[model samples]
Target: MATYNLNDIVLGVDIGGSHITAAIINLKEKKEIKSTWNRNLINAKGTSHQILQGWASTILQSMESVETKPEKIRIAMPGPMDYETGICLIQDQDKFRSLYSLNIKELLAAEIGYDPADISFHNDAACFLKGELYGGSLYGFDKAIGLTLGTGLGTSYTSSGKAEDADLWNMGFLEGIAEDYISTRWFVKRFYELTGKQVADVKELIDNHAGSTDFYQVFSEFSNNLASFIYQFIQRETPLAAVIGGNIAHADTYFMKETQQELNELLGYSFPVKKSFLGESAILLGAGAST
Candidate 1:
């Protein structure tokens, strides 16, 4: 079995819309201890106690897996949240609504028998970019954008090694907002509109309808919409590059190349749009590095 020095390790946790993932990370090595990683499904609509206990249990499992206590725990959470104070202000987002206005750090610390000072929170989108900037695809870039394409669109911008949420999910695009056109819901909605059938997500659409013209049509439209969004984002941020992550990015083969082509045409120059190199580990590494 692998052994770790407590001083060299920290616990990194990522709370998503429907799950929580925890892992021990070796800060010096900038990598996750895969053996210590734990993920558990969570009911976002549950009571605060249920949600908190679920998170605590998963974190404790990770610690037990590693057989050692970590020096600290850092969480990557969705917002509107007060990262500095570790308070959750999320509301009307259809997730974590039960946690509104709660002191997450104190509650989590109490559940896990740790000092409140030992726990910290960060915006999930920023964490994704910070992870890339730390040791993944965006390593050498001083300025870049990160987009997480999944249940909801997550956006972040990084400059000089610091990342902040871009909060562009609701930004106006086409007739609605950027997310309305670029997110997983768009694919489901579009496919259903075309065929009067329902798909759970992008993967199912691709897997089951790979040969359907409607499948290719949906991707083509999505690619153009994504490129248009990126063009505007680049104009505002002028990032050196952009890294795409999240569950939907797994379908990059269908949209990435076309998105790049459309973006180049729109900009009259080539721009870098790379796939996430770190995958889910990016959040764990980012949380650990922040600590």
Candidate 2:
């Protein structure tokens, strides 16, 4: 690990469908400055200006956590986005519709009084994997896959210190698309289909009924489904390991063992499937790594 001077740190931010988080990371150290971490809920349904202001406010809060100002920043955000141009092309995706076709870097910079050129962007999934590869579980591996198991299946790959989006969420899968079976919506939908109860999300189901056999069965099926998905990706990519992150990872204790079991049985070996130890900070660390 390398040591970094305070002036070499950069602000790192993660933008989600419903929230935003920011922190500062020492590029040379490849470590997040814990004191600089901050997060805030954002209403993605708000108008463009409102959303911008909310993001700006949260970003300011994170910046305030540090003494010296950040002169450069990097953001990990979802797409359809033009990372190079810092434009958001997201549309009809149930979040941030107000930002469709807007240049997020320019918009956010204008709101926060920073030069747009000082900011850069990368795919959120890519950033997550990059963080892991740089400082988390995948640090020793040259080739690996990462999945952010949340509202959607965020996929990414890393090889030789470079990370990129897998873009496999929409690919064809069992009876529909990959995300149909691999995301939080799948858990909610499958649970509802099985029990006729409309729970908010998998977290809600786990929190309310984790001890129940019904929800346990749901997690079993989810583990099987995820294992199958990983099998396919592994066969194609041959990654040394698969690292998982996102909100659903909070329930890894309940489902990950079975997932690992299924993968081991299918592959005839113990293929590592590890949950992100860094959790939410992974993206911030990753955004900084990318910077």
Candidate 3:
């Protein structure tokens, strides 16, 4: 075996509608020893620059506290974003519309004194799959896909360790788009309106349902639709497996079972739905991998 010495560290950040998470990753050891800093993303917050500055503050503070100097910044953002230009175009479709034109990579580098060469960006969904493909739960699935069910639905498709495809988030779901119909935001809002009970979000529903038949039924319906979409994708461009890594994946096993059943019915062949192995650290590890 060839001996390898240490290399510079990387700072990874994932910006979701619900939260902004940051972590530090050591490239040599292949471990994200530092815990991440996550803060709730207020829909009513200031402009994208301001919001991003807030996120950067959290990340920088965390690094300082740990006495670590990460040499590169790797960020995973929502889709319809132009990774080549650092332009975000899915604003109207995203929960955060005001952040449409924010040049995140450039801004972060300027604010933190990091050179342009020290930063990069990718679709959050794609990076999620990269995380799985590299070392996450679906590590061995050379052909696979990953989904993150958050404020809005996100997906990343991959084959042979490269992520370059899209799926059921914007193109085909409900009447028009997946985010409008099947997001956790919709799941919680509709549930509260129908049952007069507030669910914190997907995580709460998965954790404390206590077999609320009505909620389970609604969730089951959503799962079926999601799985059906996945099955259709599999038919068009087949893959060996699928991995789930969103907050929703950890909840009541029944939801996954419902989804699996739908996939089984429409899937041309058999496969497995593995739970996420990396959790939040995936973005940083994946971001570093991108570099």
Best by lDDT: 1
Estimated TM-score for each candidate: 0.93, 0.93, 0.87
User: What local distance difference test score does each model get?
Assistant: 0.89, 0.86, 0.71
How far does residue 279 in candidate 3 sit from its true spot (Å)? 1.3
Candidate 2 lDDT tens digits, 1-291: 233455679989999877899988877777777777888888888999999999889888777755677788899998788899888888846678999989989999999999999999989999999888877888798999999988777899875669989988877988999888888878888888888888977778977877877898899998998999999989888999999999889889889999999999999999999889788888998898785
The digit string of per-residue lDDT tens for model 1 on 92-136 reads 566788999999899999999999998999888889999988889
Q: How much is the lDDT of residue 196 in candidate 3?
A: 85
Off by over 4 Å in 2: 1-6
Residue-pair clashes, model 3: 0
lDDT of 3 by residue, 1-291 (tens): 112232656777777776777767667777665544544455523677677677677667656645547676788877777787777676566455666776766776777778867778877888888887888788766888777776777777875559753756776666777666567777787777778888877777766775788777778777787787777667765777887776666663757887887778776556787777887777657776675
Worst 10 residues of 3 by lDDT: 1-10
Q: Clashing residue pairs in candidate 3, if any?
A: none
Once fitted onto the true fold, the runs of candidate 1 whose alpha carbons sit more than 4 angstroms away are 1-3
